[model samples]
Target: MKLNKFWATAVMASAAFCGVASAQQGYPKQPIRLVVPYGAGGPTDAVARIVGQAMSTELGTPIIVENKAGGASSIGTNYVVRAQPDGYTLLVVAANLVLNPATGIETPYDALRDLKPIAALANMPILVAVNPKVPAKDLGSLIEWIRAQPESVPYASPGAGTLTQSWGEMLAQKYKLKLTHVPYKGSAEASRAALAGDVPLLFDLGGVTAALIAQGKLQGIVTPGAARAPGLPNLPTARESGFKDVDAESFLGLVGPANLPQDIAAKLNAAANTALKNPRVIESIRSLGLTPTGGTAEAFGSFLSDELKRWTAVAKSTGIRPAQ
Candidate 1:
């Protein structure tokens, strides 16, 4: 009886070990879903499809890019947050994940506590642009023109609590300008508003607005980044435009539900870094006006934390509250 019991224990342990090994080796045996928490054709969706295709090649599995946009991106974000932590369902979201909660909007999931960071995908500067009807030609002139308006000048953003809005608020505060917030459903809508002159000023991802700026419908004022954006080399950065404190950028990254297996996370991170290094992938991302950022899972987590804290402080200073 004692020998039989020992054999049983050994068999169970061996089976468990084999299961783990098999899981690690056969990860993503089926299709992987990459959920984009924004509308299709937007920067986040574009990055998702780009990285998804690259990761599919590396992982030998199909990665389906799904758009689950709405509710300031909380709807799709919560979907991923509540998903299984099996590495199959992942989220590719923009900086709105941090900016949403930082601005006091109640989300269904706690970003830091409920999600495991997989990798930082890319970063894009926010381009400040104005409608052709606006008299501003540069950041300084825009500020002065805004000041001259009898009422608060309206500025359009992708959404109310997005990083674009935060950057708009930062600019307003830095220059002590009276600006009213105009929220749109997505980048397309916001861009339309700016082009139609519904709002004189707009803040959007640099990649999405670069073409419009070139089309002469909108004037590129400044980019809120530490340096000039690669896509808009002629546009000065906020710092260069004399607003050093107005540095803001939108970053996209991958994450899974909390408690994702370490080996799986490592594998995904490695694949992402490899994809970012691909010459084609690099060029594709750069063409979209995004700088590829492939780093360890830990680094992505730290970046998210820092962004949350930074944006939270900005919210407080700007007196931004959750939209009713």
Candidate 2:
């Protein structure tokens, strides 16, 4: 009886090994869902769809996109963080995934602790645009103008506790510009307000504001990035605009619930990287005023960590928090 039991246990171990190998060999046996933590047609969703399409071709499986927008992305992000660690459900999230918890109120999931970052898909700068009627032609003039009328001028953002508002707050403290903040439901509304001259200044994603600047509806002052964007070659960066320690850029990427299986993460990473290399995908990103950035899961994880640390300091210094 003892000999029979030992043989049975050995067979079970062998079967388990084979099962794991088989599972990895033909991974993603079904559709993969890529969740975006914002509404459809936004920059995050646009990139998610492009990358999802590329992944479908590379992985020989359907890649589905799901948008869950609200709570400044916490509602959707929390859903993915609590999802099964099978890698089937993924998130295409903006910088808010890291920024909100670090700078805003309580967050449902710890970005670094509850999510496994898959890749850094892109880094997008925010544009500092003003209504054409604003008495500022460029960065220097804008600074002077802001300095002159500290209390009267106000800036609009996608919402309170968002990157847009955070930049506004940081600018106010860094430059001592004392501009009031007007939060809108989203970038579209904020941009509209700026266009209508309701708000003289706005900090919004470059992709959304680039067209307006090109059309002469708004004037671009400086981009919140380490350097000028390729599409907006004439625009200066925050550093160049004489603002020290205020370089900010929004990155969009893919992340899954913490403890996702190693093999599954590897499979998705490979598929995503392959998709990123496609010429059409590259063109699409450039058209949206974004540069395609793709890399290993570890790199994105570190980027998120560094951003959280950086923004936490900004939030503390600027005294920014959710509206009462």
Candidate 3:
């Protein structure tokens, strides 16, 4: 009886190992779902569709994009964070991935601990622009104009606790600029307000304001990046603009639930990098006024760690919080 029991246990272990190997070999055998933690037609959603289609072609499988907009993006993000690690359910998230936690809010999942980075997709540059009516051409002149105001000057952001709002709040707190933040539902509304001069100053994404700058509807000041954004070459960088300690930038990336198989992660990373190199893919992302950025999963993981740390410190120092 003892000998028979030992043989059965050995056979069971062998069968389990074979099962895992077979699953990894035929990974993503079904349609994959790409979850976007926001509403449809937003930048994050747009990116998911663009990259999802390209990656689908590369993998010869259909990639479906589903929007789950709520809890400032936490709802959808947590869903993926708790999903199976089989690579079928993934996340295409934006800065809010880190911003939510950085704002000291309780999140359902830990970004650094619960999600595995797949690839860094693109850079969403933040443009500091003002209505043409504002008497300022650059950030320096804008500062002077803001100081001349009788009360706190009003500025618009996509929403509170966003990278745009952080930059605005940081400047207001650090430089003593009397600025009032006007939080909008999203980028489109905020840009409209800035265009209509409802809010004279605007801190927003480059893609939302790039065309307006071209049309002279808004005055381009500076981009808070290490280098000038490719879409807005003439615009100066915040570092060069003499604003020290402000290296603000936003990006989109892919991630899967924690403990995602290493082989599956590598396959998706390769597909993403190849898709980013395609001419159609590159042009599509550029038309959105974003720079295509693809690199190894390890590199993206490191970038995420740094971003979370930096944004958390910004939230702490500037006291920025999510809009209620």
Candidate 4:
């Protein structure tokens, strides 16, 4: 009877432990690290900080925003892809997550396969920006001028594998323009080049160059979205600017190492959705010239896959093959 009782007690203890483990599986028992794979003050960093702060409140723990910028976001992205699949480490992936892989570059990690998307955070519209010295006042004049003197006009982008670079290439191919490609170390540098008139065009996210346009230091010819930016509703979209199919925007999202627990991912996605819905956070994100979007992991995953296929075709058509 003593032995039987002891065995029953062991079984009960195991069941109790299993219940505790199951309860713990609900997620976010500790602080989480949100890694922004870009320099501080960049668009990705700005969005990550805002979302991270609001999510911290919803999760009942501090969500730290860590800037890990370098190698076209590869260094930081690879760091997170290699992190433990636990919910502790998360990444703020940008459109470059898809563009980089399509560029045939030696990225440290594969975005679609190595990381499981948690939620989409925001979308930064791409703008056709130029310094005031460009002389083209609007999209039509700019197109005419570029068509007349394609090779003479040079454009700047954050890097070769970035969305800006991809857009510039696509624009060149679509319009049969001969714009020179000038890749900068980062978006800030590329925007500065446009501001200084070193580059005549900027095919980059509006968040990087919107202030210059507002201050009249730069001009916006078009944006690569179906609709004008809410911040600049007066500007026309690329489709309206005469290129009916030139719709593209830099999408931002959160992801973690692949194979993350479904329950943990669900909790994180809930917190992110809550964060994006915060009024103050929404205002901040819009002020940066982004449209906020927080949705299911499945939605984000599908979006990523579509982007990969779309940009891969873009790269192939633009002759952007992997460097030997």
Candidate 5:
């Protein structure tokens, strides 16, 4: 009787191990939901759909894209944070994930604690632009014009707790420019505001502004990074304008809820990387003025950690906060 009991326990243990292994081996037994924490037709949503479609083919399953925009992106973000760790639900968001935590934007879940980085999808160089009616034609003139204003000039950013906001504040502080921040829900809305001259100046994603600038609806001032953006070669770099210290750029990446099974995370990361490699997917992403960036799960996580640290320091120095 004792021997039979021991054998029964051993069999059960083996069966459990096999069950887990089988599940991981045959992952994505169902459709995967890719959540965007912003409105549809926005850069975040666009990237999610393009990459999600390609990943669907790689994983042999449909990748459903869903937008849960609101609360400064807290709504959809929290939705993924609370999802099951079975890898069915995921998130594709921007650098705001780190910005929210670093700038104390009051998110429902902490990104580093509640999410797992799967893979980086792309990098978007942030640009400073103004309405065509604005008197400034270049970065220097814009700075000069802002300083000469009698009152604080209004500038628009994607939202509070974003790199654009921090960068805008940094510029105001560095140059003593009297600039008032006007935060919007996302890049798409902010661009529209800038287009309608509701906001004279804007710090927005290059991907969203390239066409606007090309059509002469908006005037591009400077692209803040190490170099000029390829899509907007006519636009000078911050370094050219002598504002080389501002190296702000937006990042887009994929993430899942924390404690997700390691195997599932690896599978998703592989699929994302593979999807990013496809030629059509590459062209689609670039057409939006975003650079395709794909790497290991570990590398993406490290990037997030670095970004979190960097944004924290910026927030401390600038006293930046989300708009009430």
Candidate 6:
């Protein structure tokens, strides 16, 4: 009886090992869902659809882009956080995934703790623009104009606890300027407000503001990035404008639930990198005023960690608090 029991135990272990091997080998048997934690037609959603289509071709599976926007992106992000560790359910999010929690927003998942970074997809600089009526042509002029104003000038952002708000807050704190934040529901509304001169100053994603800048509706002052964005080459970077510490570009990436199997993660990462190499994908991303970024999973993970730390420090210094 003891010998028979030992043989049965060994057989069970062998079967379990084979099951794992099979799962690893046959990953993504069905369509993969790529959740975008923002509204449709936004930069994040655009990136997801572009990258998802390319990834599907590489992986021999359909990649579905689903937008579950709300709660400052916490709702859709949390949905992905609770998803199975299997690679089918993935998330394509902006830097807000880290910025939201750093700025004291109540997020259901810890970005660094609950998600596995699959790959870095793109980087989009935040364009600092003003209504043509602001009378500021560049960053220096804008700073001086704001300082000369008798009262604090109002600025519009996408919403509270978003990267747009953080950029405005950081600018106010760093330059000692008096700027009041007017949070709008999303980029479209905020852009409209800026265009209408409802707010004299605006900070928003380059993609969303590029067309307006071209049309003379808004003047592109400076981009908060280490370097100038390709689409906005005429604009200076924050670092070049003498605020070296004001680097606040948005990084978009792919991630999955924490503890995602290594093989599956590697497969997705490889697929993403392959898709980024496509010329059509490159043009599509650039047309939206975003730079394509493709790197190893480990590199993306490290970038996310560094961004979290950086934003946490920014939040503390700027006194940005969680929403009520």
Model 1, position 218, has a per-residue lDDT of 86
Q: What is the TM-score of each candidate against the true structure?
A: 0.87, 0.89, 0.92, 0.87, 0.85, 0.92
Clashing pairs in 5: none
Judge candidate 1 at residue 307 and give its lDDT.
94
User: Candidate 1: what lDDT?
Assistant: 0.86
lDDT, candidate 4, 59-156, per-residue tens: 89889999999777888999999998878999999876887778877786777889999999998888788888777877778878888872567888
Each candidate: RMSD to true structure? 2.9, 2.6, 2.1, 4.0, 3.0, 2.1
- List model 6 lDDT by residue over 173-202, tens digit each: 878999988888768899999999789888
Off by over 4 Å in 3: 1-7, 148-150
Q: Model 3, residue 295: displacement in angstroms?
A: 0.6
Q: Cα lDDT of model 3 overall?
A: 0.88
lDDT of 3 at 20: 82
lDDT of 3 by residue, 204-300 (tens): 9876687888777788988887667766778898888787676778999999999899999999999999999999989988788888899999999
The Cα RMSD of model 5 versus the native structure comes to 3.0
Question: In candidate 5, how many Å is residue 96 off?
Answer: 2.4
lDDT of 5 by residue, 1-324 (tens): 999999999999999989988988899899999999988997789999999999999999999999999877789999999999889999997877888888887877887889999999988888899998889988889998888888899999878877888888888877778899899977789999999989899998775677888778899999887666657889988888877777777889999999789999999999999999999999998888888899999999998999899888878988887677
What is candidate 1's lDDT per residue for 124-186, written digit by digit as tens? 888889988788878888888988889999988877777888878877777788999998876
Task: State the displacement of the C-alpha of residue 117, model 4, in Å, after optimal TM-score superposition.
Answer: 0.9
lDDT per prediction? 0.86, 0.84, 0.88, 0.84, 0.88, 0.87
Clashes of each: 0, 0, 0, 0, 0, 0
Give candidate 4's error at residue 71 in angstroms: 2.8
